[model samples]
Target: MRTIAALELADCRRIAAAAEAMAAQHQASVSLAICDGGGHPLLVVRLDGASPSSTAVAMAKARMAALNGKPTADQEAAINGPRPALLQLAGVFKEGAVAMGGGLPLLHSDTCIGGVGISGMTPELDGAIAAAAAAALQGQPG
Candidate 1:
């Protein structure tokens, strides 16, 4: 049976707010996306000047990490292996998953309960912003 575990509106807002704050500090527009534990999108936000392409890129990268229950950096690092299908089918390369940084998995306890992705900036900055957003929602109620 399929289960649903989407993020609440309040949580989504909190994540976006964190991302916006970081983006403002960096003087960069960004696309942010949050996905549930199951890698389904719960919310997506794109700043006005953010690149249109970053929206999809952010979501895909976040979902990839969330689905695997690991940081996207690790996933990308292991992309090339005996089975190319995982990376190929995932379209991970196109999503910028293998880049040095940009995607991070969100966690609750030891389980990865979600992921936050930010794009439209340097990969380091993207990862930083996403991490900041997740940190913001760390102790709050859903």
Candidate 2:
């Protein structure tokens, strides 16, 4: 059998903190989510001034990143571009893969271990936060 790394609580906390820091730096209010390899939530936070709907959207983006091992922006591009048909597949997911920016997978040794997602402000700001959070995983133990 092969062994794969998984995210621990500390990793989740670290990612969330990084996301929050990025948002704070930008003076953006957003919701953040961290999830395990299986798309299970580890931590979720909705910052002040964020829309309540953003909380659910953040979680959905995180789940999609974790399960797909891809950034949600790519998914968004696909649906918005030549592959609008992809939306049909999204409908069947337990939480539809949020086809938007602001989600990234946590990779260790090139393998996805989890994901981080952010939402509320502009997609650019949210994606920046998610990128910062995913970067926090660098140098962390498996």
Candidate 3:
């Protein structure tokens, strides 16, 4: 028999709590999103004062990270300027998958099993909050 894994409810909730805590510590309202390994959103939260549009952006960021299994920072260099090919890689860009800061891959035992996206602040701030949450999950027991 074949087996596959999916993001658990507890995992989603943990991520949301951690992300919200980090963003609040930074004094930034944020839109947080969690997606499964397939880049489909499992959970989303927009803190008070977060822009409504930030929700979509957060989802896109999570999708990008889940699909790529790499930090969105790496994609930033490729998406700049007129000759960028970022839009042609897997038909994701057209759907608003932003390959920039604020998105990070979530891992378990060195396996990238999901991703988190954060928005509603400066790109740097967004990235910082996301990184904080992602980093906090490191070395956590399953």
Candidate 4:
């Protein structure tokens, strides 16, 4: 069997902290989620005053990025563009796979090792925060 890199607890904490810092910088309440490459959740944080729905959306976005190996917004565009039908299929094919923005895959050695998702803000801002979290993992071993 081939070995797959995974995020450690420390890495998860770092990603969460980075995302939280970004949220604070913007004075936004948000929810963040991190998942392994297999789309299994590793960590989730719902900041104070964030909407309750954000937690679920955050996890869905993380799963979408982790499994698809791309940002959730890109996936959303693809599905809504050439393959509009895929949007319907997403429900049955990929449970908890959202097409919205704010999800970023974490890479190690150019390979996707995990993903981070942020919610409770505009899609652009959420994506930015997730990107920041992913960047924190840059140059780090899996």
User: Which of the numbered candidates is closest to the native, going by highest lDDT?
Assistant: 4
What lDDT tens digits, residue by residue, belong to model 4 across residues 1-142? 7777789999999989888888899998999999999889999999999999999999988988888788988878887789777576357635787889999988887789988989999999998899888878873322
Off-target runs (Cα >4 Å) in candidate 2 are 140-142
lDDT of 2 by residue, 19-103 (tens): 8888898999899999888888899999999999999899988988888889999988998999897677556666646768998
Off by over 4 Å in 1: 1-6, 80-100, 140-142
Model 2 clash pairs are none
TM-score of 4: 0.90
Q: List the residue pairs that clash in candidate 1.
A: none
Instruction: Give the range of the ten consecutive residues with the poorest summed lDDT in model 1.
Output: 92-101
Ten contiguous residues minimizing lDDT sum, candidate 3: 133-142
- The positional error of residue 96 in candidate 4, measured at the CA in angstroms, is 1.2
How many backbone collisions does model 1 have?
0
lDDT of 1 by residue, 1-142 (tens): 7454456879878888888888888898889988887777888889989999999888877877677667666555665544445566366334434322466777766667788888788877888888788887786422
Candidate number with the higher lDDT (1 or 4): 4
Better of 1 and 3 by TM-score: 3
Question: What tens digits encode model 3's per-residue C-alpha lDDT throughout 11-68?
Answer: 7887787788778788898899999887888999999999999999999888888888
Q: Which scores greater on lDDT, model 2 or model 4?
A: 4
Which of the two candidates, 1 or 4, achieves a greater TM-score against the reference?
Answer: 4
